[model samples]
Target: MKNIIYVVLAMLIFASCEKPNKIAFVNNGTLINDYQEKKDVEAKFQLKEEAFRKRADSISQAFQEEAQKGQTEAQRLARSNRKKAEALMTGLQQKQQQLQQQMQVEQQQLTQSFQSEIDSVIVNVKNFVHDYGKTNGYNYILGTSDAAATVMYGAEQSDLTQTILDALNADYKKE
Candidate 1:
């Protein structure tokens, strides 16, 4: 019984005396805010959005012309033509809906692509940090998101955003 108590006390002391490992944090916001590749991706999406807008404008003009023709015809013929115009309008609406859906899918794909890029950047950053830590004799390194939970605040001066962004941009420039 005494030996058991002694053993428990020794374990507690050892646990209490353990030294904390070396740690560093990475901010996710830095990747979005400072990364040139992220800016390029956003620019690409904007161009796609503009193209969609132009297509929609042409569709709208065609619909308006057909609707105006129905408005100008005589009453008897107008009824038949109005029905046809309505059908055409319905088709146009469907086309518009389809275009909107396509745009949504494209937007989602763009978001996914950006997410993938961010993940790849994170992997590269992790590799660089691992190598840097080893070369500099750091025992452990930690990464924090934009919120910087473990580290409530880190100065922009200390932020490694530019370094990581430059590395990512350089790598992408090669490809």
Candidate 2:
């Protein structure tokens, strides 16, 4: 019984003497959304998206005008000849299909470009976080997410969102 007590006391003293690990956490959602570089990236992509939309709208307007002309001609032909009207209607539908396919191709291309750019940004953010931790002498820089309690309980003092954001923004300009 005395040996057990001595062993327990020695273990307690050893544990108490060990230095606590240097640790901090950043909210991943907050980090990405409020990141300055991310904002700039989004702005650039948004411009591209708007431009695409404008071009698409212009094409759609032209297609609509063509359809209206075809419709009017179809009405007149139908009154005179059913076979001619059917051919006109089929031709207009083919044109509509071609226009739709063109729009889809353009939209897909834009989407793919945006996705690749966004993915690159995400990778840079991860790299920055890793470098930040190493340079700051952090033993562990945990990440939390707004969608889930990745870190259910952390002291407010350990939250390093603003610090990382500041470093990220400053580095972004240099890049």
Candidate 3:
């Protein structure tokens, strides 16, 4: 019984002497926004959005011109053939509706694609941070943002946002 007590005491002392856990935190918003890959993705999507807008505008302008021409022709026909003019106006209206629908579908598709790419980049950043923590012997790595302060206060030395950002940017450049 005495030996058992001594053994338990020894184990407790040793456990108490063990090294403290390694913990760090990064600014979630900063890390994600400053990541090189994320910036690149945003730039790419911006260009695509601009191009889509230009194309949409061009299509709209051409359709407007066509509609103007059709209206003039319909007016001339109405002077002699009222039924034919009514049919031409109906056809033009249907064509405009179809064009608007097509443009809307195209815009929706582009938005979805852009959102998917952004989601992918966010996932990649999270995975990279996870790997970095594991590789660097971190027991815990917390993320904090202005919206949700999971880590309200941490020592300046414990803030790893810039370090992780640098490493992430370097890795991106390599890729």
Considering only N, C-alpha and C atoms within 3 Å, which residue pairs clash in candidate 3? none
Go through the candidates in order and give the C-alpha RMSD of each one to the true structure.
5.5, 2.3, 2.2
Q: Answer with 2 or 3, whichever has the higher lDDT.
A: 3
Candidate 1 residues lying further than 4 Å off, grouped into runs, are: 1-20, 73-141, 145-148, 154-158
Per-model TM-score versus the true fold: 0.56, 0.85, 0.89
Over 29-59, each residue of candidate 1 has an lDDT whose tens digit, in order, gives 7655566665776677678668766876776
Off by over 4 Å in 3: 1-14
Candidate 2 clashing pairs?
none
Q: Candidate 3 lDDT, tens digit per residue, 1-175?
A: 9999999999999999999999999999999999989899899989988999999999999999999999999999999999999999999999999999998998899899989988998898899899999999999999999999999899999999999999999998999
Q: What shift in Å separates residue 8 of candidate 2 from its native position after superposition? A: 6.8
Worst 10 residues of 1 by lDDT: 69-78
- Best of the candidates, TM-score: 3
Q: Who wins the lDDT comparison?
A: 3
